[model samples]
Target: MSSPEHKQLIWNLIKDIKVGMLVTKELNDEDGLRARPMSLVQDAYDGTLYFFTSKTDAKAFEIAQDKDVCLTFSNPKDNVYVSLTGKAKLSEKRDLIDQYWNKWVAAWFKNGKDDPDVAILEVKISKGEHWDSTNNKLVQLFEVTKSNIFESSTPNLGESKKFGTE
Candidate 1:
C-alpha cells in the first residue's frame, strides 16, 4: 500500500491503544537504553507523534543528545503490534501545548499548562512496522496447532508490513 494508506491503517490499529513505550538511549544506564510509557497526544495519525513531557526530565536530556528514538504500540486483544523509529525534539510551542492540553496532562504539572516544565516532545517518524492479526485467539491457536501437526509449514499468524519513510 501507499505511505498515506499505511499510515491510516496504523492509526486505526493503534488509536485506541493511547499509550506506547518510548525508548531512548540512556548514556548513564548500564543497558544504554531506557523505555518509558508515554501517552500519545493526537486526534488522528500524521507523520509525527506528540507527547507531553517535562523539560527537566531525563528523557528530554537524552533526546537532546541523541534525537533517535523508538516507540512501540501493542494491543494484545486485537493482536496488533507496531514499532516506529524517529527523531525526537522538545518543543515549548504554546500553540501546540494549548492544542493538546487536557486535564490528565495537567496532573503532571504543578502549575497546569502554564508551568515552565511543561513541554511537547515531537517525534517525526522515519519508519514504522506493524504485525496485525485479524483472527481471534482461538482461531490463531488453531492455526498454530494445525501447522505444528502438519509440520510442513509455519502458521499464518497475521499480516506484517513495514511502512513509512523507506
Candidate 2:
C-alpha cells in the first residue's frame, strides 16, 4: 500500500502535466510496444489515472488483450519526469465520462459527452518513479559547472523516488 504522503508526492509531480505517453504491447506484433499521447482527465491524483478514448480505438483493443501498461510524463523545462506502471481497464460509464468532459474533448467526439463510442481508460497504478529538479536556468548551469570543476560524478540535477507497491 502507498502512504498518503507518497500519493501526495505523486499528485504534485503530475498535477500540471496535461499529457502522458500511454505505452502498451502491440497485438500480434512479436512483443513490440506502442505508445500514444493521452490527455489526463483528472487534475488531482488518486492512484488511478484516467483518459478518454473511443471503444473502437486500437489502444482499447490492445488493452483488452493485455492490461499491463506504462504512462510517462515529462517536462524538460521543469526537469520533472515520471513513469508509472499500471493495469488498464476500459469503462463506458457515462457519469464518469461526464465528470471529465469539456469543450476541448467535444472537438474530438462530435456527438459530445453521450457519444456511444466514448470510453474511459482507467489505469490502476502499481508502481511509479518520479524525478523533479529545480527549474531555474542559472541553478542548472551552475550545477553542471560545479560537477565539471569538482570532477564529481553526481550533478545536482534532481530528486528521484519510487512509490507504490513493488
TM-scores vs. true structure, each candidate: 0.94, 0.90
The runs of at least 3 residues in candidate 2 whose Cα sits more than 4 Å from the true structure, single-residue gaps closed, are: 145-152
Over 108-134, each residue of candidate 2 has an lDDT whose tens digit, in order, gives 999988889999999999998989887
Clashing pairs in 2: none
Measured with C-alpha atoms, the lDDT of residue 106 in candidate 2 is: 86
Q: Tell me the lDDT of model 1 at 120.
A: 98
Model 1, 41-159: lDDT tens per residue?
Answer: 88987788999999999999999889999999999988999999999999999999999999889889979999989999999888989999999988899999999999998999899
Best by TM-score: 1
Model 2 residue 154 lDDT? 64
Candidate 1: regions farther than 4 A off: 29-31
